[model samples]
Target: MSADVIADFWPYVMIVVAGWLATDIWRWLGVLAAGRMREDSELLVFVRAIATALVAGVISKLILFPSGALEATPMGLRIAAAATGFVAFLILRQQVILGVIAAEFVLIGGWLLIGA
Candidate 1:
């Protein structure tokens, strides 16, 4: 290969290695630790709860105080969709996919109805 081709490839190779190092190291460690960790342990339960809370907080933030296109959607519609989805999730025996679909349908339908 010519030097120019190697030069172009060098940055891509560096990016791949950098990205892998940034994410894969922790994932590898998690895999190693998972083998020894109990799935039902209190610590694991607490970790899961914290992770869920963090996700809920982020989603709530986005829905409540969104930017760009999301900001155009009414607050009541967003809240209604979330409430409807939660009810649907409960009704469907906690099937997340169904719940998410219900939520998306509500969001899109509301957006169309409101002409946002």
Candidate 2:
């Protein structure tokens, strides 16, 4: 490759390599650390709780006040789909993946119907 081609590609190459290092370095560290761990420790439980809360907040926000493509839909319809799906999921027992899929399908199906 020419010098110009190398220069153009170098930044992209560096970015990919840097991203890989930044993300995976912690995984290596975590694996090493986990080899000497205690079960159900307070710190671990706290971390889990915070992570779950953060994810739940994100999910609720997405369903309640969505943006981009979701902004096109009515908010009430979104909430109703979520509620109906949640109820269906609970009534059928707590199969989480099924619940998520049911909720997602209801939302998308509602969107399609409303959009038409």
- The top-ranked prediction according to lDDT is 1
lDDT (10s digit) by residue, model 2, range 15-112: 77888777898789877866756667877777678879989999899888888877878888788878877887898787777777887888889888
Worst lDDT run of 10 residues, candidate 2, spans 33-42
Per-residue lDDT tens digits for candidate 1, residues 61-90, read: 988998887787889999988888989999
- Output the lDDT of residue 59, model 2: 86
Candidate 1 C-alpha error for residue 76, in Å = 4.6
TM of each candidate vs. truth = 0.59, 0.60
- Model 2 C-alpha RMSD vs. true structure (Å) is 3.7
